[model samples]
Target: MIRHIIAAIATLLALWAMVFMYQLDQKAERFRQIQEIIEKSKQEVPVQKTTQPIQQIEESSVEEQMKKEEDEVAKKLKALRERAGSAMAFKVSPLYKQKCSSCHGVNGEGAIGPSLIGKSEADLYKALTDFKSGVRKNYVMYGLLAKMSDADLKALSEEIATFEEKLKAAAE
Candidate 1:
């Protein structure tokens, strides 16, 4: 009975090996066919006839093409400048910069934290106090404001309240 079991296990392993080899062969055959197709495509591409006389490119068309390229570059540069300008558009107090800028963006435009711009100073102060006093549930905000004084929080709120006006001025 043991001999029969051992023989059966050996037969199953041999069958599995055969199936794996067959699958591998199929994949290898497909790879070879794909390589052949790629080689044929490369060889079949029509080579431009060098025997034909080269026509002189028009100077006006060349100049026009160069102008179009320059315009595209200038447009891309302008877009990049706009993005950079918005990222650090207005200045904030050093206290806010140190405590809030990492999450709340340099201009209070919001990064990880919600936008503080356009908020009333009272609303801002309330939210900051809530975070500090454990009224709000955010661990990150609570941790950040924990060590800070009420005066600092009030100062930050006042500075944040003016972000919208500063952004408007920057836009102008």
Candidate 2:
């Protein structure tokens, strides 16, 4: 009976050892496969190459194209500034200075012409339009407004009508 029991225990131990050995071998094989994959990936990764002659030529052409674009943009901006700079400045008083200030006073305080300081925007716009259309006639004003567009007239009126506010701001 003792001999049978011992033999049974030995057999069980042998089976467990065999299973452990097989599992270890499987794990070692898995580790070997992972190492191979790592080595392959390292070889597959691309390295940055030195620029070739053709690439260098292409880069120079691209740079020239960019420079041409920049120059064109600059020219366009200069043309724009030349075209509408006065209007864009939002100070139509310069126009007044050129055409109306000698008569109207520098601040619309009334020189030879009537004071424009406290005029409403609507009134000023109507007056300017009336002047332009010859409904209100002054030879000098008529000539000054003859070629002015309605938009310019409107802008001028808006600026002139705000003179009181400008005066108050200056005082403060």
Candidate 3:
């Protein structure tokens, strides 16, 4: 009877030892997996750093594109303003269109009215003002000049200056 009891105790201890060994192996495998995950996360750090430069490049490219578009818009606006200034000076002035165009031609190469292409602002202002104030009377120009305001006269003078500059540049 004592021998049988000893044999049963030995069998239980063997089973317990086997179970503990298996659990230890499982824990070691889990630790190894966790170590592999940590290593993989470390490797991704360099990749994240590299992506920062790419993001900066993209941002700079967007800024460059916006700047290019703004430059194009500014160029177009300048061209339009230049064209309008030329038109106002040579063709679209109220006096030119209403009274002078019939004799001065569209660009002030005169048909009956004198060519006013290179006239100074002071001369033009004096003539227009005299016409307005009845100091220099003309049946045709007096009515038109009297209707123009000071702002209109100034704008016309500026347009003439712009036209002269454009002509000078073109001649050069």
Candidate 4:
């Protein structure tokens, strides 16, 4: 019968269409898997942008950052500086500990480098300025003082000059 033959033909077409669509879907899936594999091979695992830590440097102003850098306190210190004024201002500073303690010892007594104790503020300042300006070219000192500001140089000089007093206190 023609009716039965037509029904058989329609069923065959439906089944073939479904098989074709399934093969296409599977091929698409394989391509996606291969892309992921390639990314993995390149060590570029995809991460959400929001998952990274936010850096404040891009947002903050240079002046704001400088003011925020260290705690500024009004304290008196004594030093025989070239330009000695009535008040020698001092603050609780971590710059020496952060920068010089590794080579000069924590107390400036002595270590990998010579003792910095009892050095005059003028001497310290000149030596540091020379090192920073490359007038005195020890690769290590040059590197250490290279990035220092004038304010930083003066502050460090003051702090290191007071090490003699700190030594006296420790002895007591």
RMSD of every prediction: 22.3, 40.6, 43.4, 36.1
lDDT of 3 by residue, 53-153 (tens): 87878767776787797688667655654533332232346544544444444445454457667878877777767877889855455545567897777
Each candidate's number of clashing pairs is: 0, 0, 0, 0
For 52-77, candidate 4 gives per-residue lDDT tens digits of: 34534433444355446422311111
| Model 1's TM-score against the true structure | 0.59
Candidates arranged by TM-score, highest first:
1, 4, 2, 3
Best by lDDT: 1
Q: Candidate 3: deviation at residue 123, Å?
A: 1.6
- If scored against the real structure, what TM-score would every candidate get? 0.59, 0.45, 0.40, 0.46
Per-residue lDDT over 98-168 for candidate 2, one digit per residue giving the tens place of the 0 to 100 score: 55555555557665578898999899989888988989965556666779999888888888988888767
Candidate 1 — which pairs collide? none
Worst 10 residues of 4 by lDDT: 73-82
Residue 102 of model 4 has an lDDT of 53
lDDT ranking from best candidate downward: 1, 2, 4, 3
Better-scoring candidate (TM-score), 1 or 4: 1
Measured on C-alpha atoms, candidate 3 has an lDDT of 0.56
Tell me how candidate 2 scores on lDDT. 0.64
- The C-alpha lDDT values of all candidates are 0.68, 0.64, 0.56, 0.60
- Alpha-carbon deviation at 170 in model 4, angstroms: 1.9
Clashing pairs in 2: none
